[model samples]
Target: MSGTQPTVTLSGGGADDARTVVRALEGTFGAPDERPGDGNATVHTATFAGETDGSAADGGGEGAGRLSAPVTVTVQGSPEAVRRASETLARVFTARDDGAASGDQEQERELHLMP
Candidate 1:
């Protein structure tokens, strides 16, 4: 926790969306250190310290250290929220041009909650 911790920001969905993502992350990383945003901009943010369960020694291997990096997540809402969320989100999520592009190219793309 010396340098800047990594962060993951998600926007455009809503407050509920932000809560959903926060819940999902909490399930894996335990309680976060900071939960800013809230109703301030319909935006929400959560920060977690880098930690691991030492499962690597138990042969859990590879991705076992997923939480080894500090992370901050934000969901979008208001205009300001959208701007900030988008900037941070871009750092975590990126556009992948897989060549196999298909479907209605005219349709606007937004974040969708998955089951």
Candidate 2:
């Protein structure tokens, strides 16, 4: 991993959406380091080190070495999270976009989901 971990900041989603996004992220990168926010807005920040799946001890089984680098995820609240949640209102949702929503150069780590 590099000295600075990559971070993904999702903002504007409400509490429910925040929870949904957090759950979806957890499913991918594991639990977060810090989760703070309310129904109005929330923020979830987590750092993923190595493969989240417990396959390293199994001689690098399937899906192993997929996330060799560390990555960070920060889910903001209300609007962003709401947009993410709406993708699949039944359960959690993880976006597959190129992270290009607001014409930002650092789109790989920054995303602004829409409802």
Candidate 3:
């Protein structure tokens, strides 16, 4: 909603893993609207400000590192946004395309990122 970047929701991983994943996306989507917090909760969410021009930002890629456990991430936004997020995550993590559901103008995809 901020621009064109998808709002990503992540569950089933530790706090470190969540931040790492967010950091990876930051490299492509710029900083998130609000940074991911430290937590043991089942889910963590990050919303990108979507102000950047999709140029490579900073924080991850090539050294993003893998998660200690599997992480299930959901990306919701326009079709283009969903596709870009999915592609970025797949490149940064060991990801499995669990599935995707589409809405009128929004698309949601679920992926599993493994260590």
Once fitted onto the true fold, the runs of candidate 1 whose alpha carbons sit more than 4 angstroms away are: 1-5, 36-42, 52-115
Per-residue lDDT of model 2, residues 28-115, tens digit only:
3444555445645445443433223633222222221122122223322333332332232222223343333322222232433433
Backbone clashes, candidate 1: 1
lDDT of 3 by residue, 1-115 (tens): 4436789999887888888888888766778877668756778999876734545743235476778889999999888778778888888888899999998878999999998
* Model 2 residue 17 distance off true place after TM-score fit, in angstroms: 1.3
> Each model's RMSD to truth, in Å?
12.8, 11.2, 2.4
Worst 10 residues of 1 by lDDT: 57-66
Ranking by lDDT: 3, 1, 2
Candidate 2 has its poorest 10 consecutive residues by lDDT at 60-69
Best by lDDT: 3
Worst 10 residues of 3 by lDDT: 51-60
lDDT of each: 0.36, 0.36, 0.80
lDDT of 1 by residue, 1-115 (tens): 3111323354444555555454444433334576534464544556544323533212212221222222334332333332333332333333221122123321112333322
Clashes by residue pair, model 1: 11-76
The residue pairs in collision within model 2 are 10-76, 12-77, 12-78, 12-79, 12-80, 13-77, 13-78, 13-79, 13-80, 14-78
TM match of model 2 to true structure: 0.40
At residue 8, give the lDDT of candidate 2: 41
Model 3: lDDT to the true structure:
0.80
